[model samples]
Target chain A: MTEKAIEISNLKKTYSGGVEALKGISFDVEKGDFIALLGPNGAGKSTTIGIICSLVNKTSGEVRVFGHSIDKELEAAKRCIGLVPQEFNFSQFETCKQIVVTQAGYYGVPRVIANERAEIWLKKLSLWDKRDTPARMLSGGMKRRLMIARALMHEPKMLILDEPTAGVDIEIRRSMWEFLTELNEAGTTVVLTTHYLEEAEQLCRNITIINHGEIVENTSMKDLISRLDMETFVLDVDRVPDSLPDMKEVSFRKRDEATIEIDVPKEFALNQVFHKLSDKNINVLSMRNKSNRLEELFVRLTEKA
Target chain B: MFSKESLIALQSIFIKEVTRYFRIWVQTLLPPAITMSLYFVIFGQLIGSRVGQMGGVSYMEYITPGIIMMSVITNSYSNVVSSFFSAKFQRSIEEMLVSPVPTLYILLGYIFGGVSRGLLTGIIVTLVASQFVDLEVHHWGILFFVVILTSMLFATGGLVNAIFAKKFDDISIVPTFILTPLTYLGGVFYSIQLLPEFWQTVSLANPILYMVNAFRYGFLGFSDIDIVHALILLSVFILSLFSLAYYLLTKGIGIRS
Candidate 1:
């Protein structure tokens, strides 16, 4: 039987100042599965990640990684996990190569093997040419990539990244997506927490949304998107209409001279809407989903919580 | 229990710490040497010419061991304080926190690094002192024992200070207000024998006096304090300080949330 990569049971954390960060939330990530952990600001995402990585002391919980309990077999659990924190936590004085190799050494990899892995990972992340430069000298995107290379140095079975591409440009972000997809395909369990809902829809197979220290939604990506009660579509028309079409279970708003937004319930049919528009003598130029489906569900879930 | 993996982690942490000091040699190494040289020139020559001999030797020779001990004490304490506190401030210490390295190995790694800097600075000060006076070790075993143990004690002290430090300024407060005052009054310039009966009794309460006199006995073959008692006191202090450092680290005091 395959083992779960991470299993958090009733995990909770209260800061020294009496702020309750995680209020008994629990979840699991299957081995080799790519999952997105989505939440809004101050939603306890980072606190949960920090407890899993042993960076923050959990007030009470049972967290297991690959069959090892974090409290009883902490060393074993830690050895299997690699963490890319939300902030840059490496020394600014050290070169890129030094930072990655040093991380391998922390995991007990020999210096020779660490050097080899550092080179390969840096090269894979497109940072080999800049390996000798100090970390402070690297651009924001390069710094993020350097963090990824460092996280992969020990060849961990699971990689957890917290906002790894927070400030990266679109080109670099897409490249990172491709890299993460390739890594996950190679049997590495990846748990990502990101603000970009579209990226989560494109990359993760499953989703878990948290708010106010509670788990509000957890399911497969396909199922979660399908649960949306209504979807808004933007239609570009050939010309502005003089009057609106009277339709049941559908609502329309005039966005502009050439654009109209229509909200279609899950029970409604798109063909009937097109026929009604045809009857109205309004030619639809093109149509597209108004916003990311996952985003819509995320907003509703967090707001409801 | 010591495993191969933990050994590697210890070596890595030690190497990283050493590299930090070496990388900033001008700031870490050079200053101690220059500071001790000034003490030698001003106190050992300009002032010693008038003070005559001390403890059955020339004034310059009497202050040499004390000067070396002072450098070791300050450098060992400063190395661990600055390095560990900087790691905390930059949040780089989380690297070790997230890794599988045991807290024992991490503490040992940093303590060894501080010891290395302390000994190196001691040797540099000794070399600078030799230019002014012919230096000889009266007892090589005692010399090595005292210096090493003294460095260990102060390094552990530095670790405790670092663990309690919340800011860069916090690291300096101990060194300036506490460590410096104790070192200066700890019989570096004058033997406690020169003090009045009451002050002499009071000097015995200071811990740095034992380290300085123990180290001084290694050089001149005599000390105002008993060498055996000095060694015993140094060992106890090291054991106690190490326990405190280990406890603080395991509790995640300053470096962890």
Candidate 2:
């Protein structure tokens, strides 16, 4: 049987102000699985993460991290998990290295070991040069990376990040994705909450969509993507044909002289569309999805809830 | 007994708290030294020349222990309140809350940090007063016990204040409106013997009076209050405040949702 990284059963949380943030949601994240917990704003994603990390108290629930019950074996449960909160929570005056080393110390890692690990993680995250600089001096991207390095200092078995790339640029976001992929590949159960649906599709093997304090969709990413009834693709062509081609299974429209968009249902194949375009003497230069598949599915699932 | 991991976790928070205060020495460490020095200059020397004797000693010598205790109380209380409140304000306190560190360890770490600052300030005030009067410790053992207990009690009280404080203003309100008045009336400059009988009876209700009188007894070998009762009262207050702070933390009051 596969080990479970996390098991949340019938979790519920109602804030002091009578806001029901979570209403009896249950889920399990398998060990070593790369997963995404995607949700729209105010959809209980953060509350769930906060409860898992012991930051937010739950109304009633049982949470186990690697078989250690959070309510009973709290210390043991916390020891197995590392959390990167949605916001920057370290002291602004502390140096990047100090922030990471101090985090390791909270987990009982010796100073010597913490220093060595801080050096390695900082270097790996491209923050070695900024290690000695105060956290306030770093740019937005560097601060995010510093939080990641700090989370990894104790070498936790599972890592959970809440919107870790919410404000990062494309280049840095892609680099972060690569690093997370590598970390997941090395047997760290990685669970992340992100607004970027494309990031979820690209990195997660399984996805959970939440809305209105409930889980709307929970399944393998492939299964979820397969459920999409239709997809739109933008095809770059050598030139626009004088007249548009007609097809029964696919709808084609001219976006520009060099680009054409096609809505292809699951029953239709791209090869058939290419055959029709070739017959029209329109050569294809490149092709890409018009919209992220998970994004469309995410919107549909969350909107219905 | 604490486990090894808990000890390391305690050490981590303790070091972090110390580092935070030291990092802003101008704001945290310097003010008390400067403030206490001024008190020695104004109240001990200039004013003592005219005020004459108190508690069987020159006014300067009488106020020396009181001044030192005052510095210790204020510095210790302010240190923990400001540091803990700032951590909460910045949300950095979540770092410890999410870790495996026990709540007791967190409490002790910040209290120890406050005690360190308090004792350091006490020493600084004492050294500064030495230039104003012939400083002496009549009973070194009682002096040490009283000073240490006083710091611990105030530090614990500071933690309680920090836990309940929601904003920057909330942290200062207690010190300004309550703590300062209590310290001033706690027999820092004049003994309770000088007060009218009724006012003296009322002053005994003040917790700070017990601490100050006990601390004074350590230096001058005499007190307006019973030394044993004062020690017992100090211990009781410390225990009560420690329990309250621990309960607040465990309940996640004003911190967790």
All candidates: CA RMSD in angstroms?
A: 1.5, 1.7
Error of 1 at A261 (Å): 2.2
Query: Top model by lDDT, which number?
Result: 1
Write one digit per residue (lDDT tens) for candidate 1, span B1-257: 48888898999999998988999999999999899999999999999989999988999999999999999999999999998888888889998999999999999999999999999999899989989999989999999999999999989999999999887899999989998999999999999999999999999999999989988889999999999999999999999999999998998888778
What lDDT would candidate 1 get against the real structure?
0.92
Per model, kept true contacts as a fraction are 0.81, 0.78
Q: Report the CAPRI category for model 2.
A: high
Residue range B27-80, candidate 2, lDDT tens digits:
877887788888878887888889988867998888888889998999899999
DockQ of each: 0.83, 0.83
The 10-residue segment of model 2 chain A with minimum total lDDT is A289-298
lDDT of 2 by residue, A1-305 (tens): 98899999999999989999999999999999999999999999999999999999999989999999989998998988888989999889999988998889899999999999998999999999998899999999999999899889889999999999989999999999999999999999999999998899899999998898999988999999889999899999999987878998888999999999998997776888999999999999999977677778887898898
When candidate 1 is compared with the true two-chain complex, its DockQ is 0.83
lDDT of all predictions:
0.92, 0.90
Model 1 alpha-carbon drift over 4 Å, by segment: A242-244, A278-281
Grade the docking of candidate 1: high
